[model samples]
Target: MGETTTGLVPTTVRGEVEGQDLIMWEQLTDAARSGLTNAGFAAPIIDEAFMPNLESARPSF
Candidate 1:
């Protein structure tokens, strides 16, 4: 997801996953980071609020 001063928005990529989604999220996040870096933006501080949710949502093996 991407957020601007106006509001939050979803990315064009969307899907359903059966297991831990961090790998997926990380990939997406990395892409975003790379984009920002390429555009000369500083490294972003991801919102910490999402961490707990991501951890809990991980698929237990």
Candidate 2:
């Protein structure tokens, strides 16, 4: 063993990485939210928006 490294690196470095990951996730989430909204699927009322239309299209006896 020449020089065994030990102990945690640093909280600030780990925090920066976590912050970057959050930023990346936010960007991706925003893009996906926009795509869904454009496609007429509101995030909050997704099922409410499509379920009624689907139900109406079913063969009624």
Candidate 3:
């Protein structure tokens, strides 16, 4: 059987995850981290540059 994959690849002209995408990104990453832990895998090390800014109030989380 083929393997199942779950992931997100955000596309933006400004090269940033904002608005609805930003919220989804946060949720997806959180879920992924939890899932990885439950699966006995090391959590991913996310770079700050790749993450959205929590200070900016563009879209509510």
Candidate 4:
């Protein structure tokens, strides 16, 4: 339902299955072992680092 049938690329991008994005992103980053040291650099390197701001974001509900 989240894909298109007609386009220049002629492709169907299956929509993410529920929370699969978060799960997949986390899975991809699982190889890294983060710690107190260099914590500042760990997140930016991954680019999926939005956890801290997410909690404070305005509640849309």
Ten contiguous residues with the weakest lDDT in model 2? 1-10
Model 2 residue 11 lDDT?
A: 50
lDDT of 1: 0.56
Which parts of model 2 are misplaced by more than 4 Å?
1-27, 38-46
Deviation in angstroms for 41 in model 3? Answer: 6.2
Please say which candidate is ahead in TM-score: 2 or 3: 2
Per-residue alpha-carbon lDDT of candidate 2 for residues 1-59, written as tens digits (9 for 90 to 100):
24434522445445355432334435667778677666852334465667877787799
In candidate 4, what are the lDDT values of residues 1-61, reduced to their tens digit? 4564442243355763333234443454434444432377433433354665665675978
Clashing residue pairs, backbone N/CA/C < 3 A, model 3 = none
Winning model by TM-score = 2
Which candidate do you rate higher for TM-score, 3 or 4? 3
Preferred candidate (TM-score higher): 1 or 2: 2
Error of 2 at 9 (Å): 54
What are the per-residue Cα lDDT tens digits for candidate 1 across 1-61? 4457544443555574334445544566777767754663342334654687678779999
Candidate 4, residue 51: lDDT: 64
